[model samples]
Structure formats: structure tokens, C-alpha cells
Target: MTAIVEGRSANRVVAAAAASIAVAMVGMAYAAVPLYRLFCQVTGFGGTTQRALAPASAPLAQRIGVRFDANVAPGLGWTFKPVLTTVSPRIGEQTLVSYTATNNTDRPITGTATFNVTPESAGQYFNKIQCFCFTEQTLQPGQAVDMPVVFFIDPAILKDKQARRISEITLSYTF
Candidate 1:
């Protein structure tokens, strides 16, 4: 009888431990996404661009071509395109570019943009000083807006052995 009682108590402890582990796993699953996003932003992992308040003080002599691409997700009822197809700016030089977005629906719709730099290695070197993507933009029916993005290619890119040879970087945005 004592053995039976002890066996039951041991079973309860094991069950409790299993339950605790399951709960902890669920919590970690919930936390993973945001934590991963923060990690990518900080490290510029997987093409995520960095944010900065200002560009490098002095621009570099070598010029790099930057191509812009814009896209609107299906069902967003929005038209979006880059104002300029491309620009050649010296490394570390601050450049301003614009994108146009128009609302096709009768009701106001809000949009947020996500951007990335191609040649994934170049992501760490792409910095945005100001961008419409930082906040959600709301447009009324038939409303068209010109959104600006100010950015620079960090001179540090030239120092990275893998990224040094990249002559052109594509910055793509999706709304």
C-alpha cells in the first residue's frame, strides 16, 4: 500500500514537470518571432536594412548604382512604384528618393512598407535615415502620395571582403 502511494506521488511529479516544460515551450514559440526580428534588425541578417539618424560625414569617391523596386501586395487596392528607377551615388553619400502610392479603393486604406537590400551581404551596409516605411500611411479614395526615403550606403561596405565587389545594390519595398 505504501509502495502504491509513493508510485502515485512520483507520477504526479513527473506530470507536473511535463506540463511545465510544455508551457515553457509555448511561451518560447510566442516570443520567437519578435526576438528574431530584433536580432535581424540589429545584425542586418537576411537582407534587413539598418536605420540611422544621419549619413557618414564624408562621401566616398567610388560611386555605386542603387536600383529601387516597389510592389503592392494583392488585395491592398493600392498602386505603388518607384519615382526613379535607379541612381548612382558615392558610397556614404546621403541620397533622397521617392515612391508614389495611390489608393484605388473608395475607402481610406492604410499601408505599411517592408524593405530589404539585395546581395544580402549588402544589407548591413544599407542605412535609411528617413522613410515613409517607418510608419503606416493612410490614403483616402483616389488619393496619391509621394513618399520619400533618405538613405546612404555605408562606407563600411567597402571594407567587407564579401561585399566590396558589389557595384550595384537593389533596394526593394513591398506594401
Candidate 2:
């Protein structure tokens, strides 16, 4: 009878431990997404661009081309396109570009944009000083708006072997 009681107690302890582990795993699963996004923003992993408060102090002599792309998700009832297909700016030079967004629906629609840089290695060096993507945009029926992005390519890219040879970078936005 003593052995039976001991065995039952051991089983209960095992069950409790399993429950604790399961709970902890569920907690971690919930935390994983935000943690991964933070990691990507900090490290510029996955082509995530960096944010900046101000432009570079002095522009570099080397010029690089930046291509712009705009897209609207299906069912959004919006039309979007870049004002310019591409622009050439000296490294470290602050530049402004615009995108046009028009609401096609009969009612106002709100949208937030997500953006990324191509030539993924250069994402860390691509900085946006001001971007419409930073906030939610609302457009009334048949309304159109011009959104701007102020940005610079860091001069530090010239020092990084992987990014130095990149002659062009593509910045793409999706709403």
C-alpha cells in the first residue's frame, strides 16, 4: 500500500511538470513574433530598412541609383505608384521622393504601408529620415494624395565589402 501511494505521488509530480512545461512553451510562442520583429529591425535582417532622425551631415561623392516600387494589396480598392521610377543620389545625400495614392472605393479607406529595401545587405545602410509609411493614411472616396519619403544611403556602405559594389538598391512599399 505504501508503494502504491508513492507511485501515485510520483505520477502526479510528473503530470504537474508536464503541465508547467506546456504552459511555458505556449508563453514563448506568443512572445516569438514580436521578438523576431525587433531582432529584424535592429539587425536589418530580412531586408528591413533602418529609421533615422536626421540626414547625413555631409554627402559623399559616389552616386548610387535607387529604384522605387509601390503596390497595393488586393481588395484594398487603392491605386498606388511612385512619382519617379528611379533617382540617382550621392551616398550620404538626403533625398526626397514621392508616391501617389488614390482611393478607388466610394468610401474612405485607411491604410498603413510596409516597406523594405532590396539588395538585402544594404538595408542596414539605407536610412529613412521621414516616411509616410510611419503612419496610417486615410483617403476619402476618389481622393488622391502624395506621400513623401526622405532618405539617405549611409556612407558606411562604401566600407563594407558586401554592400560597396551595389550600384542600385530597390525600395518597395506595400499597403
Candidate 3:
């Protein structure tokens, strides 16, 4: 009789432990998204760029070409394109550019933009101080808006061997 009682008590303890582990796993799953975003922002992993409150104080003399590209998802009923195809700027020099968005549909539509820099290695050096992509945009039918993007390349790129070799950077956005 005593053996049976001990066996039941051990089984209860094992079940409790299993339940605790399951709860912990669920909590981790919930935290994964924000944690991953934080990691990307800090490390600029996987071509994820960074955001800045302001541009660097000084710029390097070396000039680099920056090209802008835009794409709209199918069925989005919007025409999106870069106002300027390319610009040459010195490292750490802040520049402002615009993208023109027009709604061709009969009703209002909202979209959010996602952007990435190419030559993947240069993503860490690209910083955007202000960008329309930071939030969702809503446009009424036939409405046209010129959205701006303010950015600069970090002068520190000159020190990074891999990033230093990059003569041009392409910033692409899609909605």
C-alpha cells in the first residue's frame, strides 16, 4: 500500500514539471518576434538596416552611388516609383530623396513598406533618419503623394574591409 502511494506522488511531480516546461515554451514563442527584431537592429544581420535619429557630423570625401528601387505587390492598386533613380553622395553625408505614390483604385487603400540594402554587406553601413516606410500609408483614390526618405551612409564603412570595397549601394522597397 505504501509503495502504491509513493508511486502516485512521483507521477504527480512529473506531471507538474511537464506542465511547467510547456508553459515556459509558450512564453518563449511569444517573445521570439520582438527579440529577433532587436537582434537584427543591433547586429544588422541578414541585410537588415538600422535607423538613426540624426546623421553623422562629418562626411568622408569618398563618393558612393546609391540607387533607389520600388515595387508594389500585385492587386495593391498603387503605382510606386522612385523620384530619382540614383545619387552620388559622400559617406556620412545626409541626403533626402522622395518616392511618388499614386492610388489608381476607386477606393482608399493602405500599405506598409519594407526596405533592404544590397550588396548585403553594406546594410550595416546604411542608416535612415527619416523614411516613409516607418509607418503605414493610406491613400484615397487618385491621390498622389511624394514621400521622402532621409538617409546617410555611415563613415565607419570606410574602415570595414568588406564594406569599403562597395562602390555602390542599392536601396529597394516593396509594399
Ranking by TM-score: 1, 2, 3
lDDT (0 to 1) per candidate: 0.95, 0.94, 0.93
Error of 2 at 142 (Å): 1.3
For residues 1-175, what per-residue lDDT tens digits would candidate 2 score against the true structure? 9999999999999999999999999999999999998987888887888999876569989999999999999999999999999999999999999999999999999999998999999899999999999999999999999999999998999999999999999999999
Error of 2 at 70 (Å): 0.7
> lDDT at 133 for candidate 2?
91
- Per-candidate TM-scores read 0.97, 0.94, 0.94
Q: Please give the range of 10 consecutive residues that has the lowest summed lDDT in model 1.
A: 53-62
After aligning candidate 1 to the native by TM-score, how far in Å is the CA of 162 from where it should be?
0.6
- Clash list (residue pairs), candidate 2: none
Q: Model 3 over residues 70-143: C-alpha lDDT tens digits?
A: 99999999999999999999889999999999999999999999888898888888999999999999999999
In candidate 2, which residue ranges exceed 4 Å CA deviation?
none
After best superposition, candidate 2 residue 104: deviation in angstroms? 0.2
